[model samples]
Target: MVEVAWPVIHATQVEQVIAVFLSREHPHALRITPSQGDKGLDVIVEQADSTYHNFQVKYFATNLNSSQKRQIKKSLASAISLHNDKDSDFDLSLWILTMPWNPTTQQLGWFRQIQTDLACPFSCEWRGLDYVNGLASKYPQVVDYHLGNDKSRLEQRIKDLENFQRLRALAGMPSADSTLVPQDLLTPLAEVVQAINRDDPHYQFSVEAGPYAPPAVSRPGLIASTTIGETQVGPFVTFHVYARYRHATDDRPLPLTIHLNEAALTEMDRAAWQDAIRFGSPVTLAPGSFTLDIDLPGGLGVTNGEGTLRLFASDLQAPQPGPVRWVIVGPASWSVIAEIEVQNGPATRGVAGGIEFEGIDSTGIMTTRTRATPNPNGTFNLNVTISLAPEQELIGLPVAQALQILRFIDAYKPGNRLAFGPRWEPIVRDSAQLIQIDAGSATALISFLTDLNLVSNECGAPASVPNWRELTRQEFLGVRNAARVLAGSTARLEVHESYIAELAKSDIEMLPKGEPVAVTMPTQFELKVAEQKFVLPFTEISFSRITIESSDQTSPDPDRGFIVFRPMEGCEITQSMPYGAEGDDSLE
Candidate 1:
């Protein structure tokens, strides 16, 4: 009951249908005309001697309407002219083959009268959809060739087959040697069997009342029997036939009830399932290390420089299936680096110094820069600038953690170095020392020193250390020497090069600004100098002869400041003199 769009049917399919119909209806019919150059004739049949029959296959979306009839008449006229010009001696019969539609008696009579009035040695006939449908019914291949089966039904059948194959393979069963029947074809066979096996009274009573009826109920004889085998693989039982059937009839319904143990099926091949479920590629990275490279930034010789390099897997928790290798080669590079700790928002700010370094920021762009101070003995000082905004601190606590990792490279090390040919190469080491070099403000310098544990209070708590103003010049010198030693040992330095650079870079904007007002922390005042070298502990050091500088670039009132020093029990101040004053000075 499906209505087909006849207009969408290709002309080639119409020709094929006609050819197939003719081959079956008239086995000896010879097709003399080719499809392309046949004028109005699609196919030609040679009858007795000189008699010929030609068909013009016409498929229409609807019945032969007025417009369609006119088209057909024009084609007929063209055919008549071609026949007269080329084959005048032959007797020709023209036929218009179309889809199913019945014409009125008047229309048929009119067509016949027109054919008679043509005044040519030919006959005309109209074959519509009814005739085509009859041909299609007899030869169902015609319908299948034109209109395919339902796509959803085909897909379901494919899925069923795939499932069956997969399950059979999993169960380790031998595949069937014969081809499987398509679902579309098997459906009709199943319906026919169901119809014949119906429990209707007409069929049952007639068969049972016959002379060959039952005869003691036939003892329930076994018409056919086959063994159903089951093999247990793990918790699931795999059922399959082991041997071929000698003479089994499949017309009867199979007495099969398939019960799949879902849990057992899911548990099969646990390792493989887990492996398949994993995501992403696995990578192994070596721990971070330091590197010293010598470069000629200003056409100089190899200079000593130190930086740290860290390697980490882009994704660590997955397994990858390929070889892993690291390649390193480059000049120098720089990038803005910020380290943030969970407790403290932003922990550190610095720049990573390296060669050919690449890192993505929040904006998803790679940032890079390169600059180094060349020193003697192939040792160059790596100058990295770090910026800390005033607003980054919360309640006197640093926001960002201090920058720890400074530089990195992508190369693998062989022995003690990564050799990139003879011309360029950098020496790689496992560890290096980091130091604090300079600071912009006294608070910054004292904070950095306290952080390094170089400055501490009487209780030896670095956190209890007072502000910079409370510390004497001697105590400051002692703290600075301690910081220098720590820096040399660690090779790390806290510097404010970024602030200087920013000021220099924006000199035009700051030229008209006035001198900034002085700011001080009032609650913090005392700084006790801890033991330096062999000195006793808890010795409070205070600055004397304090001088205040004013914004006018001149010394302020000297009487405004006072000096006080808290000495230890054994210590005595024998003579006190201001630094750089020519006088007898001794500490006893």
Candidate 2:
């Protein structure tokens, strides 16, 4: 008999208990992870070595509440839905197991009252070790379902759930939700249910014989690691890991360990060494429950201007939840080996290959640097550099390897530090990504800014701290001229009193320069793609020499990515208007 232990187990426990019995009692058998789309069951056993029985597993908290009862009802409803599909004629036998006695006074009454209302191939049984003696006394054949037995499917399922839950806690996302038979899979589910519904197509399904014997349980295995986020901190690298597990008891701390390649660790650019420890708030492992978190680092903004950290895990040890490795990228001058062992134990060369960044920050913490610019055509150009400490050199990192390095470092060592070299390349498009600016039109400019809700600060804030007086068209134009100084990152296309000083400077610059430049001022521009439209407004007309090769630093590479416009032919400029000047929608 299957012996399943956990903080909770839903219907799947009952399936395992039954599997244990059938595996021994019947012939021509093999097991399959039950319900390809069903999350509740661990596996299903069939008679002809083909799909037949649809089993489910469930984990319930000791304190059953109205909500949980509702969930159970929901799960059952989904099972019925699956069974009703126009598929095979396999009979349905769903089993739900708890720690032992379950169902509150009200719930038990509800279950008793609603038993008939529940659909076919659906049944609920609540029993535990205490009931084992009843089987031994009356039906010794069901002994396979007992908990203490080896090779029991129930035991294995419990183990698998335990490990699955543990890793899930680290990943920080919910366990895989119930497998809704997508419309595509509905046909298959239908065929399976059609075969099991009845002996004759006209006859109704019947569970004439009571459960012949209890099913066996199998030990569930440890879950694999999942990566979360990665960031660079000078030379150090950090990674986050997640997995899941099932617990056999309550409040019991699960012994865990992490493994990483030592060679990769020693070769990583490490600023300094810090103790390795768990990365997040501690959690208690409850039976049948699964948890998830930011399992492996790679999380945005987890690194700083320090060193990159590299990681590796020990392959020999059983998997557990925790940080695996934390290695700092060292300086370029240092002499470090390419490989090392886990916990400084062994070494491997391939692990050291990957791109890495290094450098010193303005704060004196080591950091890396990279340059990025937008193209006039609206794409981005990125220059990234990777640094490695003496320790990171042995591996002579590859680009993909470098990504993993950043993940580990960011997870363990986090800060508002800068990254240098190739690591700092911008992944996002500049302000031009969603909007464009037109040149030399006042109404266009005003409408654009209006759409964007942008306002400038030419007139200083009135007596009110946050409110600034609205500048007139001329004043707003002047503010646009001085925007470079008045607002750097803070500047938008509108006018504000706080920017008055900068606007004055701009006014002076715009009057006249020694050489004649084809000066054009920015107007508001709007774009429509599909059904959605976006508007951009600007006060200043940014002019550039229309180079033979489009000069938009942020524009996409013409050869590789999309380029928006063709080479500019001589064009007419019918208008030289101020910020408030009105104009027809059609360009003259």
Candidate 3:
């Protein structure tokens, strides 16, 4: 059962390889032969230069494991045992022959197992292709580089036929006797293997023609519109409050709530008015319009024409001002409507304005009258007059400075009621000291502390009038002198000959540590300027230790994400350290 054709082919190939090797060693004899059944040796070759080699040819188109190698070692051991009786001296080099290959981990592990279990001397495994190439390089004359060129062609043809048969089975097709594959079939398979070799399964036609796809975005459209009407009669100028709301395309309604002023409510019947005009009333208007109206009462019940009935349109009224904010939303058809803004007028004198101030503690002041008037409750009326120069008007400073002045007064005095009066009011009405100004300029501001009185000195007396004793002058002044001085000095005035217009803008409030306080502006005045309409969704994403450095670990680029360190969150970044990759000792 020799089936000896393959051995002839292998011997011829070995002959050229041995010849090539002989040329490297001069004056050497070389012989290559097949296995002799008596000795059970696969191949034995002798060199003329007192050298010899033992050969083993492995013809496998697949991988080898540890167990198979162990079997080969067992056969070698048996052959050696049979030859133990003969006395001979033979030097040997073991040569292995196979295709161009390197052993995988499993195959290497098998070779290691053979060494460990069988106690073999050689621990290294050499590739057959490398040995052949090395031999050809060593003995160039006998190498005959093209000796295996025709056999390689035949082997390649056989491999091609086999691969086509395997693929035909995979593709649910029938294999034929034809050796050449169809161009269409071979082209596709070649492309597939190329893609696989490139490690890009995504490029495969089987994966690209999948059924899944990303969802499409949808645009919003106008959904619905409605109208509302109200008509009534009464004697007084009645007040009506209507809530105008809109239902979004998604069916979510945002109701509007507006509080009526005292003037508008004073003349109307509170009981009857609240009954008809309830809270959360929907606003309905003509089609394609966002308008609504509620009829008001006339002088007595009027059913006739031209009766002067108060007509109140809900759209005519502006939203109540808050925190001095302003905004404009539009559909691009009409002029921009200011959705938020403060009403600027002198009417805010008695009423509250956008600016507000609350007292922190009590304060005091003194007058030059040197007299105390008695009241109905027998409590003395301590009137103080803190004077300013004729040109020193106090109505020009920013209101915030005025507030700080009030706080300063409170720190000086513990419990004193205060008010800021006009310049024409008594500067020395009751018992007060005159604060003579060394600097006569109108814009000259009084310092918080001075030589005469420790103005803002927590442990010292007043700077304007220092002689007064037994009077806790800190709680003496009724008018807010500090606020007045602040309002006068730091403030800018828009003078119109008769009346002064406040033009000075207030500075942002400073926290204790000189940081700007995050105060919420009034809903009426905040502005959102964006390149395009973008909704800032309600999301809280926390960023922890953005400046993390791990030279020993792998990390992606820090600048490649949500940019955790935003400039606005008060992240006062001066410099950033460079990031190093894992195992990168180049920086060293």
Candidate with the greatest lDDT versus the true structure: 1
lDDT of each: 0.35, 0.32, 0.29
Off by over 4 Å in 2: 1-36, 39-42, 47-55, 93-106, 112-115, 121-124, 128-588
Candidate 2 to truth, TM: 0.20
Ranking by lDDT: 1, 2, 3
Q: Candidate 3's residue-wise lDDT over 37-76, tens digit each? A: 4232333456666434544434332355556565456644
Q: Candidate 3 — what's its lDDT?
A: 0.29
Give TM-scores for every candidate, taking all chains together and pairing residue i with residue i.
0.24, 0.20, 0.19
Which runs of model 1 end up more than 4 angstroms from their true locations? Answer: 1-16, 27-35, 86-90, 94-96, 150-588
TM-score of 3: 0.19
Span of ten consecutive residues with least summed lDDT in model 3: 347-356
Model 3 CA lDDT for position 118:
48
CA RMSD, predictions in order = 34.3, 25.9, 43.2
lDDT for model 1: 0.35
Candidate 1, 1-588: lDDT as tens digits: 333345567766665555555544554444434545555565566676756677666665454577877766666665677677764543566555444455667768866765566654566777766676676656443355445523244664565556555544444533475444344334544443343323211111011112221212111212211111222222221111110111111111223222222344334333322222221111111112222233211121122322221211112111112211111322232111212111101111121211111122221111221123334575644432233333222222321112111111112111212111111222232211132222133345534445335433322443322344556766665455444433332112122111111112122232323332221111111333533222212121122222222222222443232222222333322211123333211221
